[model samples]
Target: MLKGNAYGHGASVTAAFLASRGLPLLAVGDLTEALDIGQAPQTSILVLSPPLPEQLPLAVRHRLHITATSPELVQSLSSLAQGRNQKVTVHIKVDTGFGRLGAAPEELVPLVKEIKKCPYLKLGGIFTHFPAAGGDRIFTAQQLNLFLKLKEEVCALGDCDDVLWHAANSAAFLTLPSSHLDLVRIGTLLYGQSPVSVGAEWDFRTTWQFKTRIVQIRTLPKGHSVGYGRKYRTKKPARIGVIPVGYSHGLELEPLTTPLRQIKHALGQGLKGQHFVFHPMGPLPILGRVGMGLTTVDLSKTPDVYLGDSVTLSMRRVTASAHVPRIYYLAGKVKCILANHEVLSPTGRKISLLGLF
Candidate 1:
């Protein structure tokens, strides 16, 4: 899934890399993301969400596949395609249990029949989603079974032999083999993350890292408070370093949904030792509350570390600030830098995504 800017790895770069690897079809969240990928004539791009009626022209012009969730949308798309004299491929989305955008089970057959009646519409695929595929085995299985049964019914209606049937996301792809139909829409696993455990054979490397240089270094006297809230204070004289990364850069941004998680997050804050940034010498502890654009790190442990030293931070990629420059490396060498919507070489030459890899 090349959606959510390929889950914040940059959709253009990710799409180019995956296309170079010969991935036949790429799926995006909407029409804009598909356009961001530029023109890849050899590879097909599918928009997971239904397009707005006015957006149909561009979608057809780009040959982008769209999701068909209702008879009304299918009819409008068919009319548009017929006017353009082009066949529009559509995937019927069945809402097995995701409770999101898709046709309900009882509505599946009628939707399929509606698509079949359209001369300009081609049924490309059928798919469903799993909301709890990671932990709820029974519920996931139930969803899978219902989707499969719906697929069988659709097949019985004829003209579904070439229809691609899929239901597996990254989580379901890892834990449930039965849910792997014709195609498995995997996103997290492709980015070196898994929702479930896998055997040693599947050795996935961490593919992303967020790092910044130490902009300043200073010392705080004993009992001096730190940060805006003064949430932390030093017992002894302490060395500190400032990095140009904070909550704005997705640092310390975590979702505490449940009460238990909220309590755990609160408890973890009191343990000052828990927050640290990585360096070759050792980990540098974060002193106190993270500011909007700056964070102070306790650097007494790494006295040799100086200004301009780079430190790696733990951050959620999806929430990371887009204003921050992204440096893409290949085989341990800097290849391209994506900054301010332009891709440039290390030597500051403009380049295309095709040349990035």
Candidate 2:
């Protein structure tokens, strides 16, 4: 799915690359995101979220597949398609276990029947989402079983040979083989994020990196406090490197995952540094809480590190800002750069990557 700006990797760039590689389909969150992929006649774009009643016309006009969550939505889509004299493709979102954005399992038969009654609507696919496929096996199994049962019931209604039934997300795709019915909607895994413990075994490589350059360097006097709330203090004279990135840039210094984990980390870091950023020589610890547009890192360990040196920070791909420019590399050479809706070559000349496909 090329949603969340392809997990902040630039949806248009990733979608075009995927299409060029013969990927048949791409999924997005809404109509606006669907239209961001530009015009790709050969590839099918599925809007996973149910569109508003008024948005049906745009979805149909754009030839985008949509999610049918209720009888009313199906009816609305059918009516819109009929008015336009076009066959609208739709996927039935059966809520097997994920308590969000899908019709209940019991509503499957009625929803399918409603869709079948709409002559202008085509049942393109049926799917559900797994909420705990990575951590809870029993719950995932239950959800899978429910989805399969509902699939059987829906298929029995009419000719469902062309309907694609899918439930596996990234975690389910890696751990649950049986959950892979007809299609797998990989998200985090496609960007090299694994929610499972054995994710390292998969031959997936990271497709994104968060990088910034040091803008300033300062020597903090002993006993000087750092950042808001005066969280960190310098015991001795220390060198601090300021990088132009922080919460605003989606670089989270301290990700409070769990209470227990927090307690463990707090105890472990007793008097030592907490979060760190990467330098070729060694790790540079963060001095304090991340601010809006600036972060201070301890650079005492490396004397050679100076202003304009690149610093790499860890970040969640989906949460990163979409405004960041995306530089595409082909075989390790810069091929294209996409920023603010403009496509340019390495030398800054306007170009079209669409012709390559």
Candidate 3:
């Protein structure tokens, strides 16, 4: 899945590399993200969510595999495709138990029949989402059982046995072997973050890293407060290093609004500590609230650390700011860089990541 800017790892660059390696289909959230991946003639792109009514034609024209969550949408898409003299591929979304976007179990037969009736539409795939597969085993089993029964029933109906079915998300793919049907729609697993602790045993390496350099360093008095609401105060004189990445860059801070909560946090800090940046010697504790563009880390322990020294943190990749540049490498060498709309090479030559396809 190359949705949410490839989980904030630069969609175009990731899609280009994956497509070059012969990825059959890349899924994105909507048409805009599909457009961001640019033109890849050989690779198929699936839009996981329903596009707007006005955007359906564009999706058909682009040959994007679209999601059909309802009979109404399937009928509308069929009309549009028929009018354009185009055959559009569609995946039927089955809401086995997720209770989100998807046709109900009872509606499956009619939905499939509707798709078969449309001469301009092809039933490419069927799929569901698992909201509790990561944590709730009984519920996940129920959902899986329901989907399996539906899949069998759908396939038993005329000419639908070959319709592809998928349900495994990152967590289901890892923990529930039965959930792996035709294909898996893994997001967190692809980025190497385990949805559950069982994944820690797997030899999955992270493909993304968040790093920034200290932009400012200064010493504050023993009782100096840091960040908004004076949330943190130094017990002794301390040195602080300011990092460029902050909440605006997708670093989340815990909300401490009440005075009691603030006091509890202050008491807990001495024992449990808080979020920190990694260094060779030790971890540097982050001081107080993360601001929009700046985060302060206590640097008293690492006196050798200076301004411009790199500070690294493990962040939720999907939430990171998309405007930040993503540098792609192959064989441990620089291949390309993507920033917003521009793609560049190591030598500073402008290029398009999609142009390679």
Which candidate has the top score in TM-score? 1
Query: Where does the lowest 10-residue lDDT sum fall in candidate 2?
Result: 193-202
lDDT (0 to 1) per candidate: 0.87, 0.85, 0.85
State in Å the error of residue 79, model 1: 2.6
Number of the predicted model whose lDDT against the real structure is largest: 1
What overall lDDT, based on C-alpha atoms, would model 1 receive against the true structure? 0.87
Model 2 residue runs over 4 Å out of place are 199-201, 220-225, 233-237, 253-273
Candidate 2: what lDDT? 0.85
Candidate 3's error at 241, in angstroms? 1.9
lDDT of 3 by residue, 143-210 (tens): 99999898888888768766778999888987899999888888887876777776235887768788
Q: What's the CA error at residue 67 for candidate 3, in Å? A: 0.5
Error of 1 at 298 (Å): 1.6
lDDT of 1 by residue, 1-357 (tens): 988778778777778778878889999999998987786535799999988888888988999999989998999999999999999999989999888989999999999999999999999999899998988999999999898888889889987888999889999998999999999999989889887877899989888889999999999899999999898899899999999998987888866756777777777675534688998999998888899999999998888999999999977777776667788777898878877767788988887886455
TM-scores, each model vs. reference: 0.90, 0.89, 0.86
How much is 303 displaced in model 1, in angstroms? 1.1
Clashes of each: 0, 0, 0
Give the lDDT of residue 114 in candidate 2.
88
Off by over 4 Å in 3: 197-201, 253-273, 355-357
